[model samples]
Target: MNISTFGLGYVGGVTAACLAKGSHNVIGVDVKGEKVEMINQGKAPFYEKDLDNLISQAVEENRLKATKDVKEAVENSEISLICVGTPSNPDGSLNLDYVKKVCEDIGTALKYKNEFHVVVIRSTILPGSTENVLIPILEKASEKKSSGDFGVCVNPEFMREGQAIYDFFNPERIVIGETDKRSGDHVAQIYNDIHATVIRTDIKTAEMVKYVDNTFHAIKVTFANEIGSVCKRLGIDAHEIMNIFCMDKKLNLSPYYFKPGFAFGGSCLTKDLSALLSKAGELKLSCPLLEAIIPSNQEHIDKVVELIISQNKRRIGVFGLSFKSGTSDTRESPVILAINRLYEKGYAKLFEKGYEISVFDPNLDKSDMENLPSNIVPLLSPSLEEVVEKSEVLVIANNDKDFKRIPSLMREGQVLIDLVKVIEADEVKDGEYIGVCW
Candidate 1:
């Protein structure tokens, strides 16, 4: 593919050389005359590992060249890769001035171009930035519709500064968020020679992937440092402890607890985290990330309660009362905490304003009960039909096998709230469905 790479900074420079090395005709675009001159002279404008030699090779082979004119580059190439910087603003937001300028220049260049072009955004940006901001700018400037006259794709780069060249060829994953299948296909073909996981998703999701990867990296670094602080206070080797901790990849370093859903509850997580924070507090160590865990978890539960309250339904049916599915233990169950808050404290308040919660936990169903249950235990329905019959709002708190049919069982006006994603959006035939985090 003929590629025009805009922005000749760290990411752009390395990308141009590497792509050209992979047997693509790369035309490097930049606003800086010095950078353009350096690239055309087969010299790296900035410092990067192995960049100078690769650029030297690519330029000498006539596969790579640099130009200051955006029009010339865009007109010559089939796909234009926007590799401009999205630096941070003073208020902690992204400053996309460089990206916006490149988009405007490309849009103007596209106005005169006759061939179908795919504009791939390789800069790191927040979700919705590509679709909401850049696409509109292209449309306005080019006087052409995106995904029609031209195509758009957000292809975020994951190159570390020093190891950029190595990371490019041996990427863990390649994300191509495209407006159309044709655009995605074109972008994916760019990496056909590389052995990496290629993920094709919507434009917004692809844009968000970069931010999530970076944020998680920041979290991991802070978490390690905080543990190091705590270990230093206890006269323990932090490196050894972390190495041992990381060795349990099945639970510690794996995707065991990374799902985007309800607050974490259960005996182990809450208990262990609390103990660690308490010990850290005794040493007067301020671990903000560790400190925020409990409150952040509580806030998630509070949001669930708030969602239930927002439904304005008096009769509420809760499916699976335990912290998770297949568990009989109710110790520190988040759903139980949510239910406890729903009940009225006094007799005066009980009759005034409170929800009627009917729970149907397969593990907690007392078939031997002859009488009604208490306010704490709530109404434990013997059958799923009984809970479905009595409640106006049904909340699925866990992933019990019995709750799988709840979406299909929803009545006309009832609201089915799913915290564990047990029910699909299209499964609910009658009532409105809502996912807690989703």
Candidate 2:
């Protein structure tokens, strides 16, 4: 395969050299004469582990070269990889001037080219950037439509600094976002011999994957540092504590609580998070991430209240009042908080105007029912049919087996606000159903 890389900096330089080493003909394009000259002389422009040797080997073998002319590089290569830098602006937005300029140059070069070309963006960008920004620029300049006259794809690099060469050959996953099947297949051929899972998706999702990974990494680091600060104040070993925390693959280091659902409110999570934040406050340590947890949870509860009030229905029935499914504990339950807010604020005026609210939880005892407001009736009926008969809107708060039967029991006009997604999406009427975080 003939390949050309733009921006002969860290990412571009490493990519060009590695591709050439993989036996593909590579031509590196850059604005700086010094960088181009260095690549042509079999030398790396910047310091990277094993990069100098790889570049030297590729150049010596005549598999790699460098040029300042975009036309020369584009005409010679079938695939052009954009590896330009996206630096941060003073206001924290991405400076895409370099990216746009490179696109303009490539689009201009594609004007005279006759063969179908594939442009793969390996630069880190925000979601919608490839379609909303890059594709339009290319189409306007080249006077050609994407996936028809040419192909466009996004193949974001996951290489880290210092160990880029090793990471390149040993990637955990390969994502190729393409405008067409031909473009995806062409880009996938670049890693035919590499052993990694290949995921083909839309261009925007591929662009967002890089940001999601990096942002999660930043969050993990901050969370650990905050925990370390609290531990150090109490003369505890933070490293050992984290070591034990990471060992729990079932929950801590797994995808247990990572789903985008309702706010968590069990005895353990709410209590532990509060204790840690209070300890951090006592030590005068500012753990912003830890401090934000409770308030964020509160905001989610408030959102549920807003959703309920938006329907403009008076009669409301709630399913599962416990903190979670199959539990009787109501302490710090998000559903309870939402219900309280709905009664006190949402239906304050409506309650006196003959509006009704009822709750049905299989686990709810007469003692647990005492916490609810006087106007909101706690149903003592064993059958869920009775509760559904009296309500205009139903809220499913937990993933209980009993709640799964509510969809079949639902009348035509009744609205469902599901926080647990107990029923399949297709089983319910489209506009009548709403998920908390779907």
Off by over 4 Å in 1: 344-354, 365-374
lDDT of all the models against the reference?
Answer: 0.88, 0.89
lDDT (Cα) of model 2: 0.89
My TM-score estimates for the predictions, one after another, are 0.95, 0.90
Off by over 4 Å in 2: 348-355, 358-394, 401-416, 421-433
TM-score of 2: 0.90
Q: At residue 280, what lDDT does model 2 achieve?
A: 82
lDDT per residue as tens, model 2, 1-438: 999999999999999999999869999999999999999999999999999999999999999999999999999999999999999999999988888999889999999999999999999999888899999999988998999898999999999998899999999999999999999999999998789999999999899899989999999999999899989999999999999999999988998877777888867888998887887888899999988888999998999899999899888888887788988887778876787787668475865575566778898777766765454444444557877888889888888898888888887898988987787777776237889887
Residue clash pairs of candidate 2:
none
Write one digit per residue (lDDT tens) for candidate 1, span 343-431: 53322243356547788888864542322234546367778888988999889988888888887777799999999888888999998
Give residue 171's error in model 2 in angstroms: 1.6
What is the C-alpha local distance difference test score of candidate 1?
Answer: 0.88
